[model samples]
Target chain A: MDLEFSPEDIAFRDEVRKFLEESYPESLRGKASRDEYEREDFLLWQKTLYERGWGAPAWPKEYGGTGWTSIQRFIFQEECARAETIPIPPFGMNMLAPVLLAFGSEEQKQEYLPPIIKGETFWCQGYSEPGSGSDLASLKTTAVRDGDEYVINGQKTWTTLGHFADWIFVLCRTDPSAKKLQEGISFILVNMKTPGVEVKPIITLDGSHEVNETWFTDVRVPVANRVGEENKGWTYAKYLLLHERSGIAGVGRSKRAVERLKEIAATEVSHGEPIIHDPTFARKIAELEVDLTALEYTELRTLAAEAQGKGPGPESSLLKVKGTEIQQRLTELTLEAVGNYAAPYFRGFPKDGDNAYPIGPGYAHMAAPLYANMRKTSIYGGSNEIQRNIIAKAVLGL
Target chain B: MDFNFTSEQDQLRDMVARLMREQYDFDTRRKIASSEPGWRPEMWSQFAELGLLAAPFTEEEGGFGGPIETMIMMEEFGKGLVIEPFLQTAVIAFLQGIIGGEKIFGFAYAEPQGRYNLNDLATTAKKDGDGYVLNGHKAVAHGGPMATHFIVTARTGGDQRDDKGVGVFIVAKDAKGVTTRDYPTVDGQRASEVYFENVSVGADALIGSGDDLALVEKVVDEAIAALCAEAVGCMKVLNEATVDYSKQRKQFGVPIASFQVLQHRMVDMFMAAEQAVSMAYMVTLKLGEDDVERAKAASAAKVQTGKAGKLISQDAVQIHGGMGMTDELNVGHYFKRLTMIGQQFGDVDFHLKRYAKLSAG
Candidate 1:
């Protein structure tokens, strides 16, 4: 096995490097560098990629994808991440677009794919409910069939970016009497602007309104909005969860976090020396870097498998279980590196929207919120516990 | 970037794994650890026949394979909890072009007062005409009981704790003024407190010329990487053993693996093990790089493996209940080995500081 990029791949990398250097917006970079980006801050860079015909790297070519090889896609992501660019939200692009292309009807495809490609429509997942998260198949959300519409009634909690989303893909029970809990589910798409739909904010420990509780009462969803067959949505839902978990590995982002931590540690002082000079603190950074390198190699191997026509399968669970935890760890170390500056309003509340005024170094303010927000990574995308059981059954046959 | 091993490497690993499963079961290993000299000569010859002892040296050094090969062998050895000095003798010194024959080698560097500092040597080797007279004590010389020769680090010119003026000398175990007090370590391996009382050695005994301390440090870093690989292998076993135990041991009329809390803990252990494996691979990848990058990778791997080892070993025993604590169970032994691995080369705290110092530069 060879790790060195081919001459052609190296040329492509140069091209990507040039584009990032020349076209990446300074204002968006400013916001992203501080973890204070709004939806628009994220959309700006995504729209730039869309214009350059590189928005969705993994989507099929027919669906406005770049059709780059797996290594090239990896390079593109590595470049974007290393440049500290805001991640193009996964819901509409990486998550929903894949499901739609694979399962959505031609009309559904024609309507949704282009909007997602252009970053004109924002989407969020409505899979988790207050009473049902890891045991997702046991969701109580109901979609009763009407003349031409399904009356939806449910509350979806931990609906990340729900306030900003224009539409949400939901899993609802269409047949309660089915033999298995999973068999009775139907995958339906709902407009957030429907009369009975409400988005109520749930401020997390970091005091950010990043997630919301979405209430759906008598929401009218047309039968045409359903993905694949009714009462067989479990199949589609499982497919979507795989895509979601696969992308949650966050290897690129963690690399950026390491870079940021190094920068902060090099500047922040403890006992008359930069904290980075302190063996204890530096070792912590080094340890994180080591863990990140491993996750990254695993991610690359997963990509190679994908290149060979294999879906993520249980490995996605491994990635999700490890990736999100690594992300959480970087934030924890960042908070620790910033020292008492991470004190003010940390886990207290986000007084402002997403941006909080700093008490010390410019980097300190983002530490607390980033750490608190990252806590959701393990809990969502199926709690790490469920992923292990999946590994036990599928990988180990235990 | 490419994580796939060559067919030869794969074959080697599989063969070693087969040997471990067939001949080095826990009971057999326990018997060996309890025996005099604390290791088996037949097993050592078996390793030599398998080319495991020669895996880290180049052909010019009269051996086949490289660091990757040695890493593969050490990992398998770790899985079996093999109480041999293959790492102590082969990878540690053979890489330094020091090993000559079947004679076991011991490194005498750490002292009574020298916590983790390689330069804090009170062991002095002053010149007396063509030969040098050495006088000092070396604490915790790993593999000491089995060592037929010793690689002793002594200060020749610089002050105590200074990095400069350090040198390494090869001394025979049966030398006139040498003494060793040997014992089994916490992890069931043999170590010794070696005393050097005006031991004389010829000028030919000096291994390398400049900055011998630095050379020793780099060699120790390689040893640390090998240890990290070994820890990863042990963690893999612990994770699997813990999961199997959970499936068999019933609690509240059901298998404990079915408990959500325990399941989550097991997953955490799995993640730790997997991450350690990843870091170990990374260290192997960075093995022959320039000193700074190599040291960074070693320290990073050391930290991750050390932490992961602790987490996996502890959780494995905790989940196994009282049976995990008994001498009859392999889980507790694995924990003991992991604990020793953490403290070896350098513990998490020590390497963390070293990592920070390097990053600052």
Candidate 2:
């Protein structure tokens, strides 16, 4: 009944705090902005965790996981936020590894797990295509057998970190004639260095390069790279996404953000006083915090259930919905707090590559860009509308 | 009390709509946005040729009309997603163009710190003998790359954020010590980070008597009304696009528009666009009203436009799904424009507060 941490959990939390405080490289300290973190910076963090035997806390212990309870995993993510450490990209460890453990062959696990653990490889998910986004089952990227290899040909867009990745696990259509659009999809891993594969940046509204358009022109991949049986990638893909949705509540980040919002309020002036003095402005923050608290507990309850070996259920859809709404509100408030400073755009096709001087306070620098980019939070992984539909069908049985 | 446009205004709308529909397709707009000058001079000439740019002036000035004409023209521009600077050059900018009466201009009022406050300026028009020495930067000067000149706002008499201190003056784009770093915006329009370092301007460059915050505010309110019409136009296209997309995009073996939940969303979008339509008309007609009434109408209309624009744009993209995120699709561009429009003159929050204040009085 109590939400208090047990002695063992407190001790684990301390160990995590110490590990992050000491092991996190100073060179990459505050420089690890989201998606802007270079390959070396990410590798540095992963390698640090690897040395501590904490590379994959959520993995099965036999396969080099920390074997901690879900609560411990939650504590680790929170501590990382408190420490302001760089976020580990999820494509490899968080996403691919879960699917691989559940559905991959022995050879696939042996080959991929070690590199993922050691931070020797970068893997990106290739589930989305230009034609298929929310209707992911309609993806048209094809992979056909050509003797020992499969000739993969198609374009995948919104490929987050595709430029930095060493490998990609793509969902390719192996049998287009199958009755269902979801049918005949195969999960196949391909080396990024393979011939006929190309990567081009797709700059978002924020003018940042976090995603890319990856084109594969008859890229040849070994047939053995396929995970599980033929025409069964959809099941594996859904499994990976379910794992992602459970963690997407982003409780840790939003809590840190509420504090940031208060700080911004205290600093920004309104009517010759700090905007926090305004009852209406303060009330907005209070209301947002109240919503966050409810979402946080909902997430905590989910984690507690998962700790008891109850796999993340469809209720993760609720967390995704509320969590993203809170995330977007935080950005919106920050944009409001910055007053007129949100207009000074920092970079504009850097003439000599120096667009250094941003207008106004440092807080205002990322406000507009972050607000622009956070629109993707609701749209990606699965849109909130889709999550609602999932709740309607899966939870309410409508 | 009337919502109907005058016959002349109707003709103007039809002319602009036809012109835009023919020459300003999505592909054409994208090409213009990416071009060297960032906008077609010929388009500006065409606007001048058709007397569309002269909508701000009286008939004797060889112009057709005023606020209502602007409303009609900008609404059409919004539908076509016109990337040119008609709002800046015609509706909001000054008239003392030494180049020609037909010379194009960009309005450069936004400072690095001015958010939506026209008075919160760091750019200075320091009194230097018979002229002023201008120094400081303007952020997001839309149409900077295309304009032969710019109408800039600066502080002349009082401290920053003081109403009495703001001055509107015309500055040449290629004036000595004036530098423009140009680039395309998220909404497929070109804007610049324009800098002035000790650039000199003649006393005649002042638009009004200088240091007229009321004058600045009046222009801003007028611009707000015009922007609202544009937003209304944006929302209508977004709503139609979403509804059309829903009927065509099938999932689960049926068109998504058949879903009750989605149909309700489309209905909400339709209502928002329709409300925006009423507000656009209300604001345009009220531009002739007193300051409180005019400002209130502008803010009230803008608040609705901002809300409608957000809901419609976001839902438009949501309904269109992944195709909305791509550059190839016109939906994302509208989404971006509607987004930037969300905060252009005053954001939803700003207008909400402004409307409340005006209401209290």
Candidate 3:
């Protein structure tokens, strides 16, 4: 019921703010704000956070975590959002680290957890196949166990950041004739550099190479890379998805978008007044703030529940549904605010590219691309429709 | 910040929702809207008994609820599509009126020439020895016929479109030299074009003297937030109803829900409803803040709700196909109400401009 931060919380917040101001890279901040960053830029920030012992706030305390309370974690996230720092890739940290901690053998944990925390290794998910997207259990990808190795052959589509990955954690079928579909699957980790493994780029509507289709043809994976028991991939995959969906709310980022929207509106003029003053445009910003505020509350509520030792529950589905849509809307509104500058296609963005001169205000360059990229939010981390079905069954008892 | 609703607020919402469910069902609402007053007196009394009428005012103003409580109640009322003048009678009038008790109230502010500007008033009330002589025309005064009292905005000293010198006066509905031309609005609620021809009122009738511009703006903003909440409720119903209909109605020998295109459209409609709900909650929470920020938040909310409402209602009807246009179906009524809600206070375009102006220092 109380929103006021305690004196200790305020002190902690100030400490975190001081650290960010002092340590966050200046050059990295510029690239991050514009959302034009290389893998090295992301890892640089991750290394700094890791060095400060704040690498994985959600990780168990034993796994190099800060062991901060949920509220403190929320505060740190809020600060990161306000700072608009390029996000550390989620595939390695939030998604795989938790599964490794829960299901990995001692050797697996010792070998994998350290590099992941230090940002030395990159990871990508190999769950979705061409025909097995929403219905992931129907995946035809198989890995036959032969002696001490499993020969894998399959294609995984929509492999986000697969080109940047050193390794991939896949859901592969080890038993094709099991009584149930979900029971035949096994979780296996594979090195991206293995023989017969290929990563083909997927240039999306935004003309970015952020995703890839990874193909595995008779790639041999050691049995030691299997997580937990055979035929238990679905359980691990579901667990990883829960971790993924919990943070998909993206409250902090959306708040930043609102600030960005205000900045753009304050500068752009229409009929002699700043567009922000134009009731038509100002109203859109105001309405967005409202939706963002509600979403902020919903996220905080989820955090509060987590503070009480409760998992995200079905409400995470609600968050994913609303959060992604709001993100999409923010980008759409941003593109609208930028006017004709958001021409859906850019000849060259930076100074040295094909088109010599940048088109509009530096801020307007990313608006259209960001809008197109955000479409994946609703589709990925399990599509929003699947989340709705989850809500219907779990929350609504349908 | 903590976002959990207090148990009391949750209980209040539940109570209002239950009452709407049992007594204010769609059939009863249709009957009441088609009747003489165009709203139910019994329902108004019940709301009064439940303190719903006094929920938006402060404790100093003899009311129990704050802005948050008002938001909760309004959201429930919105869900039920309640035809009562809670916004006009309680939110605008009770707060602005010189005296308030059992009587229903209406706001006579928007002039024929003023458009959406509350300050653009050609209506003038010249002061006499103890009272004022009022002469003006007020267009689209919602809840006009049901209200026993009227809160009229008039220009006392400034030019027709000036922001200053505007006064709020309380005029009795039965007063002499007053005329009201009443008709049903598109949303099935009653409104009026009220006229004041040399109408006289005592000095005591001036609740806020000619310079209460901020007060007028705040009240209107609150009303706008409440209306946004109502739109969110209607959008919620429209989305669900459309989905249900799509699942049942077959095309190409399969239910329309089987089509991926229609499913994606439903998802879009659902997201719009969710975003509208979020924005409505946001604006309602901002209602009690400092004037500029409050106005800015209100306009932002109005814009979002208007957009989301339009998208959801129109998409709902389109998904439902031809039957969606019929009066027998509830989607058309929701669409009509949603359309009117957008035009209230200010439409999306107007609010966007207002937000831009207010945002600039």
Model 2 clash pairs are A340-B115
Chain B TM (all candidates): 0.97, 0.95, 0.96
Clashing pairs in 1: A279-B353
Interface RMSD of 3: 15.9
lDDT of 2 by residue, A78-175 (tens): 98877778888899998999999999988899999999988899989898886677778999899999999899999998889899999999999999
Better of 1 and 2 by lDDT: 2
Error of 3 at B27 (Å): 56
- CA lDDT of each candidate? 0.80, 0.83, 0.80
Best by lDDT: 2
What is the C-alpha lDDT profile of model 3 across B123-192, one tens digit per residue? 9999988899899888778888778888899988888777788899989989999998765554667777
For residues B1-361, write the lDDT of model 2, one tens digit per residue.
Answer: 5667778888888899899889988888877765666677788778877877778776776566878888888889999988778888788883634113366778888876566778888899999998999999997787777777898999898877788878889888888999987666656677778899999999987878777888888888888888888887788888888889889887656788998988999999999999998998888888888989999998999899989988898778778775665566778778777877878887887788988999999
Q: Residue B205 deviation, candidate 3, in Å?
A: 66
TM-score of each: 0.55, 0.90, 0.56
Chain A accuracy as TM-score for every candidate? 0.95, 0.96, 0.97
